[model samples]
Target: MKRQIIDTIEQYETIIIHRHVRPDPDAYGSQMGLKALLEKNYPKKRIMAAGTHDVLLSYLAEPDCVAEEDYNGALVIVTDTANTDRIDGPYFDRGAFLLKIDHHPNEDPYGDERWVNTDASSCSEMIYTLFEEGQASSGWEMSAEAARFLFAGIVGDTGRFMFQSATEKTFEVASSLIKQNFDRTQLFADMYEVDRKILHLQGYIYQNFTIDENGAAYIKLTQEILKQFNVTVAETSDLVGSLGNVKGICAWIIFVEEDDQIRVRLRSKGPVINTLAMQYKGGGHPLASGASVYSWKEADEVIGKLQELCRNY
Candidate 1:
């Protein structure tokens, strides 16, 4: 499959890379890292990262202005996105051929060609494997800029190697990526640093979270609380993992209220939570998943289900 993707890369003069919306580091890393790799090797070919620019991720690279006409003959490769509905940019199907490269389960598969590796830590890691294949078979070379993006993705999805997803091979990939000339220290600073307002919200969560006997915990960040802290819904994502550090916590959920609905983030040390995420309106990894609910009543229902899962586990 790697060889086939490399072959397809050689066939096109225009390529557009995309990722999931509500962008994360893994999303940007895989999409732009692949763009950097392709641009370095095939400098003549036009490669663009297509998506809305996320200001919070300005520490990384920015996306390009890919108009509709640009996709007419482009080879569209979407990375790190599980399903079609989650893909960020439009006109993904307007291209000549569509490709899906992701590390998520192939539950909602699309594209003319698909490479899904659920065992891989992140799509950025899979992109590195593709680079290895390209190096041997296609004489491809990776630039330091590409390495920075890929490394950030690996670290982000694996929680800086704290999550269970990081494997022996994940460490090996990180080792190889660091050999390229990039500022690892600065990258780490940019990836982990949170604003003062965000930190205050995290403190509030630590102080106010509700926990059950089964160690099922939850915190609700209502719009009122968000205004109180002057924090946006997007910035609240950094605090979702705060509950994992709490003692006797088996599973946790953080509900952030958006304009009309609530964003549900589910994380677990023991029981599967993606099933719970699916019961709402979202899905992701078993240990970490996300969902959306319409009201506080539905939010309570999700919490009840999570408590049941933890109790049974």
Candidate 2:
């Protein structure tokens, strides 16, 4: 599969990379890292990374403004996205060839070629493996910038090597990337640095989150509450993880109000919560998932389901 993907890339003079909408570090990292890797090896090829901007990861790379014509004869490679509906743009099918590279569950496979590895810690790790295999066979090199971006994705998705999905293979892949001579300490500093306002937001979550009898911790953030904190919806992405470590809390959820609907971010310490997320309008990994609900009643029902799961566990 790796060789096939490489061969497909070699056949195309234009390659466009994409990821899910409202991308996280893993999405941005894999997309940017693959683009950098391809550009370094195939300098003559026009490789561009396209997606919506993630405010938190904007410092890494900006999404290229790709024209429709760019996909006329291009190979479209989507990374870190599982479903077609989650794709950031409409140009996926416009490409001459489609390739899907992801570490998520294969819920929706919409590509001519796919390399989906759910066991991998992150899509960035998969990209690293692909590059290493491709490099060995084709004598291509992995650049330091590419290594850094890939490393960021691994760390981000693995929660700084704290998540259970991060295994020995994850460490081995990370070691290879770190040996490329990127500043590891600086990268950690950059990833963790936060301003005072964000710190206050954390305090708010800690203070205001409610705990159910079944040890499910939850917080509902309406637009007014978000306005009070003066934070955008994107900034709340990391807040759900903060509730994970609370004492006696087996499950945690954050319900953030969007324009027309409510977005729910669910996390669990050991229980399988993605099933419950799928019952709602979302699906993801077992321990971590996301869902969308139309009203507070729907959100409450989802929460009730999570609470039941916790009680059974």
For this target, which candidate reaches the highest lDDT against the unseen true structure? Answer: 1
For every model shown, what is its TM-score relative to the native structure? Answer: 0.70, 0.70
Model 2 C-alpha lDDT per residue in residues 140-249, reported as the tens digit of each score: 89888999899999999999999999999999999889989778787777677634456788899999999988898889999998899887788888677988778999
Candidate 1 yields a Cα-based lDDT of 0.94
lDDT of 1 by residue, 1-313 (tens): 8998999999999999999998899999999999999999999999999998776688898999999999988999999999999999998999999999999999998999999999999999999999999999999998999999999999999989999999999999999999999999999988766445667888999999999999999999999999999777888877889999899999999999999999999999999999989988899999999999999999999999999999999
> Which stretches of model 1 miss by more than 4 angstroms?
195-199, 205-313
Q: Once model 2 is optimally superposed onto the true structure by TM-score, how far is the C-alpha of residue 117 displaced, in angstroms?
A: 1.1
Q: List clash counts for every candidate, in order.
A: 0, 0
| Residue pairs in candidate 1 whose N, alpha carbon or C atoms collide under 3 angstroms | none
